[model samples]
Target: MNTTISKIHPKEIKKVTLGAGAISINEIIAVSRYDAEVLFSQDYRERVNLSRSVIEKFLDEERVIYGVTTGFGSNVTETISTEDAEVLQKNIIRSHAVSVGEPLEKEVVRAIQFMILVNLGNGFSGVKLATLELLRSLLNHQIIPFAPGEGSVAYLAIEAHMALVLMGEGKAWYNGELIPGNEALEKAGLQPVSLGCKEGLSLINGSTSVTAFASLALYNSIQAAKTADIAGAMSLEALKGTIKAFDPRIHSVKRHEEQAITARNIVKMLERSEIVEKYKDYRVQDALSLRCIPQAHGAVKKVLKDAEFTICNEMNSTSDNPIIIPEDQGDALMVGNFDGTFVGIYADTMAIAMANLAKVSERRLDRLVNYHVSELPNFLVAKPGLNNGYMIPQYTAAGLLNEIRVLVHPATVDNTPTSANQEDVVSFAYFAAKKAYQISKKLEYILGLELMAAVQALDFHQPLKPSPVSQKVYELIRSVVPTVEEDRYFYPDIQFITNLIHEGEILNTVELIIGKLDW
Candidate 1:
């Protein structure tokens, strides 16, 4: 495949400085998505050097440290001589780099690299300063490692694959070409360094992969959540669904912050709507999908909110085994900080949350196309029988929802022992975060179909226009996809609208009209 890496102007590129404070989710997104440059603060360099000195002191004292003088996992008892310590480190990376599948997207690989910096840069992983410098060089230069998308439990195989690139052993993408790792480094004016006492273990061990996926997924899921509100508002207006359910008084009585905020957002989006005003008191209540949107969408928002805290904490944490503590006199404490339970559970929860968002969106999509309910023409088309306008798009939405449902099964709930049962009770957080990321993409498409159908349903209302916010959203959709007078290839229309949702165009447009939606 032809892959081209675009170069950003130096002045335009944003730089994220580590070691100053905890890395935020926005900074991670900046590096991964926007190619933001990463810099190490002087304090970060000092801390990393201090941590590395601890390992050197341990080796000098001939103290038996885990993964330093002793073998890892099940082979913890196996001792290694000083001369063979470096070999063992390199060997572990080679042995563990066995993940097999399609290569992950560059953004994900970049996120993994950034998380590695965050984890080791905390001065607990005993990683050498040069080691982190190389990793940062790879990110700033856009030399992405070729990490496979599958075959990881917690974070071992994939991280091993990534670690191999630093050793100048595995393949990497550089300047749009998949080249040898060493060559990629060479082209980028850098050289690989030999693994130190615990460098390899520090590189591969930990919850880096799971946390990387969770961070990216959480960021996108937040955007998708905001877009879901816009889509739901448009659907409510199109269905002539009453806005009484969204009154501040009704939501205030419940005392759920997100629920009240969602109710307010829906009301704000539908302000000055001729369609809604004409249909006010048209019926006792609309369908639960339209009427109870605040409750349903707010619940999803709550999950996303909770996930942000968990994921951001994980982002700034050091999830290394046998973390080195200078305060404890360079003592290498063997611990289970690498366990991915917290991140795994949250990632799984985010997946379920996104699936529910799609579920509610599909219901509203049905209301838009099904003539039995939607007052508009069958399937939101001018001539429904002749051209199957939106009949099949709803099917597409259902298919995507089904795929998301299958992925919602928590991977963290299951485990298999490895390392000769020494590393038993594994947290399959890698898959959980991976599936959550996958579900977020599918949810975007589902929401896109809802917006597409909702826009069509609004067109039928004619002189009785939607609210100002909804009209702005409609214009944005119409700019990308024209009204479906007669169905031509519908996939492009769905794709265009999906792009709008994915790029936050719909949310951005709505927010411009009615401030920001509450988290």
Candidate 2:
């Protein structure tokens, strides 16, 4: 009752978290459409025209502006006719759509659209209300634009989004078929939004994609880290780990906040476990993976907390250049792009933390599979030389682990100058963070495979009984993997078992019987 819970509000368009799953983008589209209702409200559009009057006064008086009348980027002082302004903006979006890469996951595409609508509705850019309405109709009617993922690199999902807006060349999955942007627009009974002078600049030149991707990655990372803790506890019991290693006195000296906290959690998870407490006579210390769970998992927790603060702020704030600035001297607003120092640093920091999580996870998988420590028949085999056992699973895990290392290289570290050196250093932070998330999923499946193998090995001891908690895990795996006797292509079984882990079947099943087990 005393605790505070975080919640999302569509009314506060600035800080909204994209909803979960494929239709999340659509959900945010609902909110963005609502905001559109506000922006183009009979009262509000009048306010925009009123806002336009200020710009008009400045224009008639010949003020030196940025994108209002002048050309963008280095071509600042080169002014264009107000009549040609809309054409200039349209050209910018079209020219910048030169993104190359795979199409974004549908949810990401939706987030980009929602963020675009939200930014436009903020009443900064001189976009007509129809611009936002066209996007709303596109979302409402499921007319997805076929945007490339090539440009969602640095700023929040801007590159591909700009591409989709400009040439109107993007694909969207409609009903069950993917279609072209023009067709999608037509099918939705809408025309492509005609951009105003600063409208396209306002749309493409921001960080919504990066923010959305970063936020999703961070959310999943928290769950993965927690899953790691549970996995560590499970592995510890299966291996007969020593409680002494997790003793509060040992952690008290280090006093690292999350480390100590997680060490305590591991202790609590192990309490009353008959295997760990009773099996102490069997082993003096568990392997490094089991003993050092706190350090590895705790590090991820700290990183996640920091990334949360940074990304949440980024999602709520603006990253567009030539940002509107209210000036008293002139009726027009002074606008310019600000530096993205914090987003760059924090996003990269998040990437590194996630990489380390996978690094440690790969090690744990090795402990379970490498024939030496696993104490099984060279690979959790039931027969001596007749079978290969879980050899391929280990190979798959190792291969995936190596891929994580390659992706772990920080995206922020290499800053190539772009926009004629106007954007000298860059973030591409979401690039690293997004890849880190994909790698995390692979590792989860990898670890789940290893857990299956470990459980298979444990079952060879027909007479020995595991602690109540681990017994549930073993039962969960048994329900899927069964006891692999002679050997039949085990990949399908591995997949079946890993899916249980990925989908929380094992964990959820464990929770149901856990209280009864007295573990």
Candidate 3:
């Protein structure tokens, strides 16, 4: 009874200030998904101005800097005069903007633009202050660049598309219409600036695009991981399974932090359940799906934690090439900081972990509806044979599970060289993060089906009630969907529960009953 949790409504947030490395995923979601205005502090603007001064001085002195004086990739040996520095920046934006596929989601485009803006605000990219402001204008005015969803090995293609929009070239989304970037700028009452010094290289040279997607993906996965636990607890009560396996003593011996956390959450959720107390069924021990909820979901939690660390660090740290050392003053250190190995590896790990979570959820859904295993009414329907009940949902879950399983193949393993072998051994972290995003959606649907079936089974428990947490979750579902006395178009019922899971309504209701679920 001593918990204090503060929640921010995304829609109500009006502004997000950026500087250095302090932005969290919530802030990103507010600006990207909720149209929150982006602002930079005076100190942030000064830092950018100072960094731009360094590059301008270098340009004045004709000091040779990688990606500034020389051509990009294999042509770095070809140097450019100060007169051509601006043109060099422009050409890179045009040349690298080769992403091909359907345009990225509007929120994703905003997130990408925001990430770019934040990185430049960090003052290590050697971009002009005006260029950074232009990026901010695109974000604030809601003119999203039409960045494609494909062709990125390490955020290059997508970011290039974003940079093109800044140059008044690429297509943009403005006023609910996809228009040319120049037109979008005109309507937004903004003008594009010509790239100068290292602006072009700086814009497309970093891993912001992949990091942006990874950051958002990590946020969503963490949400799904917590919701998965709630679904497991609800399934446990509905199936009349004991909480013996979640005993602290059993988990204390292993000392796996995530597993212990998950066990504690389950224990708290099923604290005073009548269903669990009267659960001496056919078998003394339940299947692994019921018995190892903590262990399985705990593994997923660990992966998500690792991903959060990697992504947040990437968000704060500058992932640019030839990073402008503000402290060192005019020294552009050329290094391979742009390598996305950490993001790629952790994203793959998260994908595999999520696939495992979904696999167990599918089996648990099997236990809820298939009467041979659940001992509940067949399909949890009043007339199983007449209506077909909740039979096809499990099949849908199975199909989604199969897709998730196939996506677990690590994208970092196969590296095809790009930029003419100058960029050999690329980390396809974008695809890995993208795959995790896809898996999270699929897993949500699978868990949604499980939640729907579990709530239906709880209806049969009747006089015997679920725990406080599960009861609240059941009521939240019933608020959106009536009890499935007979299967009326079950897809809508499944979708309603899925929306609850995705929108955090069910998780919020359950957490209110029993403090916050384990991370």
Report lDDT (Cα) of residue 188, candidate 1: 92
TM-scores of all predicted structures: 0.96, 0.81, 0.96
lDDT of 2 by residue, 1-519 (tens): 111113222333433322211223223433433332212345445534544445556556656656657876667658777777777766666666666677666655666666665554544455556556666566556555666665544653345443463345666666768877666666666677656555666666666666656555655565566566667776676666777888888778886788887787677666667667766667777777778888877887887777667665655455665554334543434433333445556656765776676666666666665667765566666674687767677778778777767777777677667667755667666575566556656767766766776677667545666656567777877776777676678777878876765555565555565431111
Whole-model lDDT values for every prediction: 0.89, 0.60, 0.84
What is the alpha-carbon lDDT for the whole of candidate 1?
Answer: 0.89
Residue pairs whose backbone atoms clash in candidate 3: none
Q: Looking at candidate 1, what is the lDDT of residue 437?
A: 91
Per-residue alpha-carbon lDDT of candidate 3 for residues 275-294, written as tens digits (9 for 90 to 100): 88888453578899999998
Candidate No. with top TM-score: 1
Cα miss at 260, model 2 (Å)?
2.1
Q: Over the full model, what C-alpha lDDT does candidate 2 score relative to the true structure?
A: 0.60
